[model samples]
Target: MGSMDRGLRALVGIGLIAWGVTAQNWWGAIGIIPLFTAAIGWCPAYLPFGLSSCKTPK
Candidate 1:
């Protein structure tokens, strides 16, 4: 969830979205949604479990 992680996540999300749209597959778009969460540095999927890879020095 650091800056780099956020950036990478955003990039990956964009890629997924593009692929999804180009492939005309709704499932692909659905898959990209998680990338958006990661890009924002806040994952709902991880929230419940309190998981994070951020290096903010606690």
Candidate 2:
């Protein structure tokens, strides 16, 4: 994944987690997916379609 993609995912993950905490619900647990992916710099969902946000070198 690219830096921008990772950053966005991290932000979204944090937001979801915060929302879950404030609402005191299990739904926030879903945020872990993005957070984990961002940390690992890999997204399984992108593999099948051969998609990537990273820029290719010349």
Candidate 3:
């Protein structure tokens, strides 16, 4: 993913995890998906929709 996209994903993931941790809810664990995507620079959900922020290699 692009820098901005990665940053946003990281932020959101952290936010979700924090919220989940604080609330002690399973929903917070869902943040792992975005965190993994941010770390890997790939979003599986975006694949089905044909969406991407990463730049193509020349």
Candidate 4:
């Protein structure tokens, strides 16, 4: 996960949590957890697949 991706994930997580709390839907909040993880540049789900977008030094 690149810096940009991490940043986006953080934003999405926050949005989902906000929506879930305000809308009274725990599911939404729960869904945001994954996004939050991705945003932080770490994805549990991607581990099995060996997926990573983080830029490497040229």
lDDT of each: 0.73, 0.99, 0.91, 0.76
Per-residue CA lDDT of model 3 for 1-58, tens digit only, reads: 7999999989999999999999999999989888889999888888889988977889
Give the alpha carbon lDDT tens digit for every residue of 1-58 in model 4.
Answer: 7777777777777787888888998866675775767755688877999988788899
User: Which candidate number maximizes lDDT?
Assistant: 2
The TM-score of predicted model 4 comes to 0.71
lDDT of 1 by residue, 1-58 (tens): 5677677777777887888889998756764775877655676677788877777565
Give stretches of model 1 more than 4 Å off: none
Compose the digit string of candidate 2's lDDT tens values, residues 1-58: 9999999999999999999999999999999999999999999999999999999999
TM-score-superior candidate, 1 or 2: 2
TM-score of each: 0.62, 0.98, 0.82, 0.71
- Worst 10-residue lDDT window for candidate 4 reads 31-40
> Model 2, stretches more than 4 Å misplaced?
none
Error of 2 at 42 (Å): 0.2
Worst 10 residues of 1 by lDDT: 31-40
RMSD of 4: 2.3
Q: Model 3, which residues run further than 4 Å from truth? A: 55-58
Which pairs clash (backbone N, Cα, C closer than 3 Å) in model 3?
none
